[model samples]
Target: MGVLVWNELSRYVSLTASAYAVWASFWGMFFRKFFWDFVGGILRNPGGIQCVHISPISWAFVLMSRRPSPRARVFITVIVKVPFIQIMTTIVGFFILALEWPLRPVKGTRFHRSIPLRIFLLAFQAILALLFYQGTNASLWSLIAAVFYIRALTLGESIGPWKEQRGTVGQV
Candidate 1:
């Protein structure tokens, strides 16, 4: 199950190799989709957004903490909890990149004007996918990417830098 979920994580791995990875990841998600459908007892059911295992932060905290039949509740909790953990880490990883490396150029120059953030993210995501499996834990990579992305996105505009060059206070 973990491998299936792990393999399916590509759907969220939109950082790089987007075109190709998308298809692969989509199929991966499809597997989970069915499992979720079965467990949820319906198709297209949705779950709440919750923080990782440190509950009180979990959406199901009240529903899960106590129950009439602990076994059924436990099973239900595991199903949702597992996915929650995966998504949490994935989001954390994405932000890690978002905060540090938006990869935007500061001035209207060669790379800034030419490169699209999507293309760059596509490549970066691909690299991260590889790292996700072999690099270490997802949390580690998530933090790494978060740092890289935040810097790039936040200060990537070249025009803003140009404003400074022109002695204008461009509050970017």
Candidate 2:
């Protein structure tokens, strides 16, 4: 029963994460504004700017920007919301959701964590994603999804020190 509950919870986490990737990728600045409004209370702390646990893609922005200031956050926050980036993210999110459906049964198991299996799943999904999204912007987006999805699955959901928001989609 505990295992069943754990699997269900992981499934919800996967669903929420995939939805967030789609919404954040598609909505652009509107999603940022919505995010700020929802988390406004937390950002109000005078001591330090709070780092939001968000999409792994957003963390890439943070690392690439490489500045430890609020300006970096502002820049990343805005950049990530760009329509092009958002659309790509949405595409990747869709792929994640599609792949996730099959993973529901094995979630939270060591079998799910096996490197060989992960490679196989990623290869299968990437091929399908490439074919599914071909002749469109998603062609490039599939590459991005391949990297992020593998990292998300292999490294765990925490992109860095920030929190991993499993429910960002539902909240937004």
Candidate 3:
């Protein structure tokens, strides 16, 4: 039970982290000038600026522009450069992870074993990918983060359940 909980938690974290990375990339690009100005202002003089009239948009851009950890940045950079990572992430997240491995149907299950559902998932993933495939560094990084998130989900699912089952077998 502990392992299962941990597995689920890790999956949620991965998904969240990746989603954030993608969102940050998009946000940073869209508000490039504002983000930089905000960051520079914060760094140059942390408490010097009086609250004259700052817009919520400016505040959001500042918050979004904060630098990520070095390891995370490197990981995102490397993952984005790879070609197949995006496709794999989409497939894993939408098809395998989302459906909880319905291809190998478990006993006593009825509704989850539909081929059409899987097909729809695949189509949805493809469409999403197409929509986001603007040739930009930010988009690439977003893809990389998405892949990491989905891969984490896959790993958590594969390892966590197995460990739980093994523990139960041992007890029995």
Candidate 4:
């Protein structure tokens, strides 16, 4: 029972964390005017950037922009309502739902039949996240995820910038 309870909690934390990531990606700013600057600004001052502890799912990832440094309750309150963040999470949620391909069920369904698998996948992801959140082995996994995320983000941006620099997609 203890394991099951922990599992469920971890799963919720995973879902919440995923939502937060999408939220940050979309609106860490632009909502209540979340201002953040690397060169040192009020929104994201020199020390504003720090790892925020997200309970049950420790060490998720919070940019910690501190233009004003509101209280915890207030900070969370604002975050959940941020326009960009909410929209981003909504879009992600919709995408995941759409992945189920509910529109055309018959005619030899493929991914539709795998809905259970999808849920399980989500749960498994939650478990992995839980490990990072509270396990003693958290640091290593977190570091790895961070590195991979950075590399992917950099590569993704590079593709577009490279294309622009070449003066068109294939004209380079």
Candidate 5:
């Protein structure tokens, strides 16, 4: 029974990791698009006032309203549209996704689990999305990515020890 549960848990973890990676990559693409567009716009018109309200939401609107440069378009296409790059990104992202799970809590203590490091990381990522992407969609997607990552981590923690124990028992 334990072995069966462990096998199911492993499958679940792999699926979850792949899904999280794909989702994160989607947000990453959004972030890249907005960031490149903002850079291209600023480079084209350095002194132009981008926003009237000067708030985060306003800035996002302003960025969304701008036209992307040809260079920016090509860059986005190469990174996001190219088939090979997409596959490689998904592969790399899976590992990146897997790594984030262990950072949330320590192995054996309740106090260590009190503070989730992923929340701080999420905040930092949100700030980057706000500053560079400056788009509502990008921010929202990043938030979703954070939520999915947290869920994946929580599920992994709940199931991981069972798998390890099952492995040891089989070895014995």
Candidate 6:
């Protein structure tokens, strides 16, 4: 009975991880399209705007006001709501990056981004996924989850250097 519960839990965990990996992959791949431009807009034009108001009700109204067909209007609405989401996401990202070499000072390599450290994070996640497997019952689900996670990580890594030049928010 204990073994049954453990395997069941493992299966659930694997499924959740797979879902997370897919979510991460989408965010990682389309971050620029979904977020960077909006965030870039905020940072570049900080001009005396000390506070931001995020109104979900207003956003819902905006969405309802549209004909619900044009991609451009949907994109604009998303952009309008993005700054709030960006704040939370950026905070999480900062916390994660802060644990690494370039962000936080450690024993070695003070000046450069640590490739080995990044690789180690990926490896650790893979090992974690392997640990989720529970003998013959669990099968390849854990491994598949790990693969997805690793791909998401790599896709995330592809979005390098978040800075945009001053006063160039919407320029091509």
Which candidate leads the pack in lDDT? Answer: 5
Whole-model lDDT values for every prediction: 0.35, 0.41, 0.36, 0.36, 0.43, 0.34
Worst 10 residues of 6 by lDDT: 130-139
lDDT of 5: 0.43
lDDT of 1 by residue, 51-137 (tens): 222355654534222222333344334333333323433443454244223344434444333323533543454444332222223
lDDT of 2 by residue, 42-154 (tens): 22223233444446765542311122345445533433333343454566566556545545555545554443443444344333223211212333443344455455555
Name model 4 segments beyond 4 Å from true.
1-25, 28-47, 50-92, 105-108, 124-172
Error of 3 at 97 (Å): 11
Q: CA lDDT of 64 in candidate 5? A: 29
Q: Give model 4's TM-score versus the native structure.
A: 0.24
lDDT of 3 by residue, 1-172 (tens): 3434433443444344334334443433333212222222322123332222345765532322344334433323323333233444344344434343324444224434433333344334433333223223333433444444454455543332222134554576
lDDT, residue 22, candidate 2: 56
**All candidates: CA RMSD (Å):** 17.0, 17.9, 14.9, 19.2, 11.9, 20.3
**Over the stretch 37-115, how does candidate 4's per-residue lDDT look in tens digits?**
2223223223433444355566565445343344433433444233433443345433434433234433134543433
The Cα error of candidate 1 at residue 163, in Å, is 8.4
Model 2 vs. true fold: TM: 0.31
lDDT (tens digit, per residue) of candidate 6 on 145-167: 33444454554432233243587
Supply every candidate's count of residue pairs whose N, Cα or C atoms clash at under 3 angstroms.
38, 1, 0, 2, 0, 0
List the candidates ranked by TM-score, beginning with the highest: 2, 5, 3, 4, 6, 1
Query: 1-172 in candidate 5: lDDT tens per residue?
Result: 3433432343344345445445554555554433454454532233332422245654543332344467666544654344333344455444334443433444444422322444344434444434323233434544555565465566554323312234554576
Per-residue lDDT, model 5, residue 116, is: 42
The TM-score of candidate 6 is 0.23
Q: RMSD of model 4, in Å?
A: 19.2
Question: If both were scored by TM-score, which would come out higher, candidate 2 or candidate 4?
Answer: 2
